[model samples]
Target chain A: GGIITQTPKFLIGQEGQKLTLKCQQNFNHDTMYWYRQDSGKGLRLIYYSITENDLQKGDLSEGYDASREKKSSFSLTVTSAQKNEMAVFLCASSRTGQDTQYFGPGTRLLVL
Target chain B: QQQVRQSPQSLTVWEGETAILNCSYEDSTFNYFPWYQQFPGEGPALLISIRSVSDKKEDGRFTIFFNKREKKLSLHITDSQPGDSATYFCAASLSNYNVLYFGSGTKLTVEP
Candidate 1:
């Protein structure tokens, strides 16, 4: 079984600052995704990549940017932190076509 | 993300009872449906899923029931255990998007 790893379990950022969250997967999957979850809310898709150098925007992609430099790694950047914002960003990967997705431990972000 | 509606934002059930979470979506293109379970400070995990062609899918204690015509679905946990206390999310995805549209989530607590 492969695993998805996300760096920096917790993050604290100041308003208007930029922050980046990184994700790495060992499953060798071709598709990866980034999602944001607020307390008591469901996960919202931010961005996804079908393969290296391929990017796709999702419903909540306006505030985030993503990169897929290689098949095993994907990264997301918060363009500008919002004051008093609190959310958790989750990363996941799945094989091509319809398949079950594996998720990584989320990165909790708080903008002070 | 894509207007997937969910009800009973939170639910409480006694141990050994059954807990049902509901979800519905407006996207007719979505052919795959999945449910995820998440614990505090952890990432969501794929619990079970069903395709649009199938009405039901079961895995151990968890079951997914789909209604293609109604554009709705549900997850039922039988004989719920205290360990089942967590948030559950229902997601839908089309073959084109390669991303899942998630519901706000349902927090279920199985109390002893």
Candidate 2:
């Protein structure tokens, strides 16, 4: 049983500040994903990578940038924090072509 | 536009009773559906799933009922326990696609 680990359980950022969230997985899965969770909004996909160095945009990818520098790691960067924005960012991974995804603990971000 | 929708934003049930959660989708092209359960301060985890071709899928106390014609599905939890309390999300995706469209989620509280 592999685990997905996310850094910085909580984050506080100022308006227009840049913040980055990191994720690491030990499942050796070929796909990694980033999702944003907001109250009453469920979860929205931001970006995903099929393999190392590969990136694909999702429905909510406009304000985020993602990187898959290694097979075991995926990272997301908030280009510019929005004021009064509070959301939880989750990282997930799965085997390519498989629908079962394992998620990390998540990082809660509050932009002041 | 949200592709997936879930009803009953929140629900409360007593132990030994049953809890039902409803979900619907707008895209008929979505052939795979998965339900994820998330506890407070944690990321979501795969609970159970059903394919479009199957009307029912069961795993222990959790069951998924699918109605392809109506583009609707429901999750039924029998013999509820306090540990079953969590937020449940309904997600849809194509069989070959890696992206998933998720519903807002239903927060279920089981009283013991």
Candidate 3:
């Protein structure tokens, strides 16, 4: 069994502030993804990496940047936080794109 | 436009009863469908999945019925339990593409 871990379970940011979220996976998977979850909205894809140093933008990557510096870790940065923006960011990993994905606990972000 | 859509934003059912969740998609290229279950404060987990080639899939008490013609699918949970209470999301993707498009989700509450 493998586990995906996300750091800083909760985050609080101010308007225009930059915030970062990190994720690590022990599954030795080849693919990693970042998604944002908002109330009453389905999970939206932010970014994904097929392997180390690879990056791809998704439907909702306008304000986010992602990195896969290492095969086991993926990180996301919020360029500028929005006022009163509250959402949960989730990280996931899969052995291959077509396989089942395992997710992390998630980081809850509250912008003031 | 949203590629995937789920009906009944929320549901309530008693123990031992069957709970059904519906999902539909707009893209004809999507050949894979997966259902995910998410608990409060946690990321979504893969519950079950089906391919467009298969009309139905069963795993323990959970079952997925797929209809290629309608571009729709449904998840049925039999003998529901309190532990089954969670938000369920339906996702669609092509076999060759790694990215998944997800529905908003259906919140299920099972009463004991």
Candidate 4:
């Protein structure tokens, strides 16, 4: 059994400000992913890492950057927060070639 | 373009009744399908899943019916309870690829 932890459950940022969210997992999964959830829009992949220091862009990776500092940690950075932007960022981990993914509690971001 | 789509954006059912959620995909190459359930202020969790080769998969009161020829799948919840109320997302991915394409989600409300 393992748990995924996300820091700062709530975030408030000014427009055009940069924000970073961190995630850590004890599952020792080889793949990590960051997803953005908007109201009624479900979850959209931002970025994913298959291994340490490996990054792959998803459909919604235009304004975000991700880092897989180690096998247990992954971080996402919002380059420039947009005004009135409100979304929940989720971090998930899974073993390579496996279909099941474990998710963190999520970080809710509000830009003013 | 969205690769996955869900019907009935919102649904309400009474306790002891059944709830049905529909999902479809555009990419024929997608071989794995997963359904995730998310409560308020939380990240999505895997509820049930079915592979293209399987026509059905069941876990307790949750069941997934898959139609590979139609590229469609449905989730059926029997004996709905208030605790079952949440947003359900349908996701598709290839067996070889780690990326998942998710639907917009269906918000189910079980009225007790």
Clashing pairs in 4: none
User: By DockQ thresholds, what CAPRI class is model 4?
Assistant: high
Q: What does DockQ come to for candidate 2?
A: 0.86
For model 2, what TM-score does chain A reach?
0.98
| Per-residue lDDT of model 1, residues B14-112, tens digit only | 999989999999988798888889998889998888889899999998998898889989899999999999999988887545778889999999999
Worst 10 residues of 2 chain A by lDDT: A93-102
Output the worst ten-in-a-row residue range by lDDT, candidate 4 chain A.
Answer: A94-103
Q: Where's the lowest-lDDT run of ten residues in candidate 3 chain B?
A: B93-102
lDDT of each: 0.90, 0.96, 0.95, 0.95
Badly placed stretches (over 4 Å) of model 4 are: none
Per-candidate DockQ values are: 0.69, 0.86, 0.74, 0.80
Q: Name the 10 consecutive residues with the lowest summed lDDT in model 2 chain B.
A: B93-102
Distance from true position, residue B110, model 2, in Å?
Answer: 0.9
lDDT of 3 by residue, A49-112 (tens): 9999999999999999999999999999999999999999999999874568789999999999
Q: Tens digit of lDDT per residue, candidate 3, span B1-112?
A: 9999999999999999999999999998899999999999889999999999999999999999999999999999999999999999999998747888999999999999
lDDT of 4 at A51: 98
Question: After TM-score superposition, what is the CA distance of residue B23 in candidate 3 from its true location, in Å?
Answer: 0.2
